[model samples]
Target: MAYLRQVVKTQSIDIALINETHCGPRDTSTATDVKTILDAGEAVLTAGDWKAKDPHWNATKTSPRGTQLLHDADALAFEVIGPDVPTHYPDQTAWVPDTIDLVVYRGFPGRIALDVLVDEFLSDHQMVVAELSDSTPSTTPTQPRRTIDWSVFQTTLDAAPSLPTPSNAQEIDDTAVKLTSLIQNALTAATTTENPKIIEDRLPGRLMKLIAEKRTLRRQWQASRCPRQKADLNCLALKVRRALEDHAKTSWETTVDDATTDWVRLHRLCRSLNGPLKHHDGSYIYSASSRAELFADHLETQFQPNPAKDPMRARRIETAAEDLMRQRIPAEEDPIYISPSAVFRAARLQRAPGPDGIPNLALRHLSKRMLASNGRVPRHGKGLRQSLARRVTRESEDSGTTTEA
Candidate 1:
């Protein structure tokens, strides 16, 4: 009880129920145990269930524990919301499982969708699963991941305006970076797409379908009490059971296969299994070439040069030679360096291709080439940042020279 109290307090549990408590006739003080468990004060609600060992008492007046629960509910302002369904079904002969599971709601009254999963025979007592919600049940669609093309991103970076004129180098560089990002975004828009897996493959949908079918059959058999009808219903139930089992087995295998590191096969599998990227209007692009064209169109729209007569929005820092001294980083000093590390960090992994069909991974590989080129000081170079900028631009041009083996 102390342990449960600590757990509830730490985890902020609103409603808690205990099963198989064995709070029997010999137990001296139930108050101490209850207080120890629900010591979080009036914040949390708790409940326990008990059953009469002997068959002498009727069902309603069976256990003192149930009476205790009712007392607690009234005192603690808890609600015992239910349709009074039998929690435990009857077993073989006179041996019936006890309804020893107690449910309590801390907040306002609401219906609890509780159902016994008979197919899952966990123990002598059947497992009951409950979903707590204010509204009706919700069905969430399952989404499946698809592969992305990364190789084309580097190629796009190659064409994006890298070697801007050093006069106002900062503005030109910013424009170039934005343009590059827009193209990559467009590429990703084309290359990466998702398909929603049918809900029938997973969870309560399939299970519920089978359960409904089985129940319908059971009801029909109960109504008719005919041997031929019972046999047919039994066969259908067996078929549904087999299907459910097969779904569970295959779903596990599929998940395992997806987790494998075989990228090429996975890519091919995804492509084969899923459809192409959808347009802005939700129309699908069927072919890779079409996807590329769509990306190109988007890139043209997004990366188009600034509108004519757009304001520069810059104030001149120095008007006179005397005021020039106060200007930050004298115009003569080297322009601020954008490090190779920064560029590499910006190049995200598993990204889709750029407008030129080069991936971010491929662009990332060129960080070495940029660093190497920038290592040596050029004799004619005015500033370190400008020189590095030129080198990066040069590297972009040369990226197409060598093919990745």
Candidate 2:
């Protein structure tokens, strides 16, 4: 079992098949022990005269100290992959052959290629070889990121034709599209020449080849009589292990940085991570188009002119403000101006675009223009569907001013 653990760790084996596991009876191991050493988010199967629980070899004599293998296997949800069969090799000396060898499974038999391996080395025992199914559907691994060449990007950007300052919105849109296309093309070209994740994330070719021969390397190191030879191989193993660890650490950091907590964040992080977007009415919006439409509909409702709320109170307030303005300037108080400062303070940084498809970035850059154009006082039943104008009234304890903001 100790040697088996060493193989699993060094070789990264997901599933294993062993004869005479003897997991049952007089043993006092926990579920955590089995799970930690072998199970990788999967089940494990055991059988025969010895398993995690005491084996019930119906034909053979029973031992006083039995195992809870039957109870444990049930608890772990492991299925008896194959029916009981004669696994122990033929014993010519015995009048009747005994069936003592066993085959244990972890997951379903679906992708597993099972076979009986008979050998004389174990005397009566035979090896049960099982090739478990590949967990990944594709043999190839997909990379969300790649090493980008800044030189290529810079060259591509420099080669792109500079557009004149956009005199109109259409020209601005066209320029944005062209720049986006150029940048995307450059990235695609740069990536094409680079090694993929499988190759890029691997150890150096020589080191990787050496790591692959770990079984032979281990055997040679163990048998070698020369201390110097053993030391040299040990040093090589350490270097290879260090390299692998560094690569794994880098990969984990990247994954963590790019991970998402919610569906919205996940979708924003990667377009491939689409999920249902629920509507305000308690239904789900599935498709991207549907989600966008629902969002736009909500924004349209907000953009629609809101009916006057507390009209009578507004009139009273307006009258009071007019009276205060007419009275005069107070000698001690400073009047505050109705400005865009409130809205600016309210704007959140790095926010996702609203239904209008405009991120805070574009709005912030054009904020001054938007604010400067605020002088056009909103007229009842006016030009645009709704107005951006907000009325602000600032006053001191002794003085007041009314401003249409």
Candidate 3:
């Protein structure tokens, strides 16, 4: 008992098993010895009649004769009890209620197992053996998988009508012309008639204002109602108006020429001015400062009746070009050069060089002329090279020159 207590306390073994204790009439002086062992504070379950040496008590108990002595012990906090089978001889055949016969120690509860009953039956003993079985919890039944009718969905989609195809460019231009004519006629009628009932009622003014306000909107509707082109048109109109206002403040004079030469000069000036020359397209010619210089040089050499006599006209063109170029290219950095060929391709691509197409060297010179300018060269080598190549191609094409490999 002392040794078992020591093992349980020091070795941390909460349960201990001692088989063949050999307690009997001759070995145990009195029943006090069994009681003394049990009262040591550990739980004890003994098999067979340890006080009887005849071995008949073990047989009568239906316990094996080999289990004439068996001791199961545990720590103070644990309890040991008989298995599901009855302990008394007469009750041995009676139905034994299912009971948890295992002795569990309090601390580290599942760590220790005495297995004394299991050991007794497994030994060479005439004991009735029973197997311990575990019961599993019952589970709920599962529902079946669901199916969908995709044909119904597809049929619903097929029943819907397709949207109308968008209107094209010719349709849009035609519409715009008709709307403009209507507005112009309304304005003329309102201005001309006596009493002008349309104006008296303010209908003509309202309608004209509405048309002006929605002219862009109408164009947008005709342009397939695309938001992107609507925005572009709005921006284009703003730029054109600004360019025209800027040009109106200048003293540039317009001169007429034969169709082909005029077209060539206009196209060249447009390239020099950066794209289509904005609102000045049908009016005055505007060129970058460098191109203006080239034109002046050309005029003096090829077309001057007398340089002294044409000085005033020459000054007017030069001054107008200079003013326009100044407004367009405000940056003080060296202007990047784009060749004439590049300008042609850009026109073909419907793209224009950024602001004025002011050549780098010319921009540098202009910057110095402006007095308040600071010059800086861009470090984009690849972009510069590409710009140069494009300009070369355009210039070559314009000059009717071809390259041979």
State each model's CA lDDT, in order. Answer: 0.53, 0.50, 0.39
- Cα RMSDs, all models: 25.7, 22.9, 48.4
Order the numbered candidates by TM-score, best leading: 1, 2, 3
Worst 10 residues of 3 by lDDT: 369-378
TM-score of each: 0.28, 0.23, 0.16
Report the C-alpha lDDT of model 1 over 220-242, residue by residue, as the tens digit.
Answer: 66666789877877777677767
Name the lDDT value of residue 57 in candidate 2: 38
- Sorting all predicted structures by lDDT, with the top scorer first, yields 1, 2, 3
Top candidate when judged by lDDT against the true structure:
1
Candidate 2 residue 240 Cα shift, in angstroms, is 22
Q: How many pairs of residues in model 3 come into backbone collision?
A: 10
- lDDT of residue 381 for candidate 3: 34
Residue 219's lDDT in candidate 2: 45
Residue 146 of model 3, lDDT score: 31
Question: Which segments of candidate 3 are over 4 A away from where they belong?
Answer: 1-11, 15-20, 25-29, 42-80, 83-405
Tens digits of per-residue lDDT, candidate 3, 1-405, equal 467457556865444433224443345333345445545434333333232211222222333322322322222333332333322221122433222222212222232222223111111222322222122112222334333233432333334332222144444345434433432333333332223222232223533443344344434445465777666556654654454444434313332243236878777655544533222123233468745765677678897555566888889988999998788556798889999998887774432344433234322222221212111111233345677799999998877754542
TM-score of 1: 0.28
Q: Over 4 Å off in model 1, which ranges?
A: 1-128, 131-164, 195-217, 225-359, 362-405
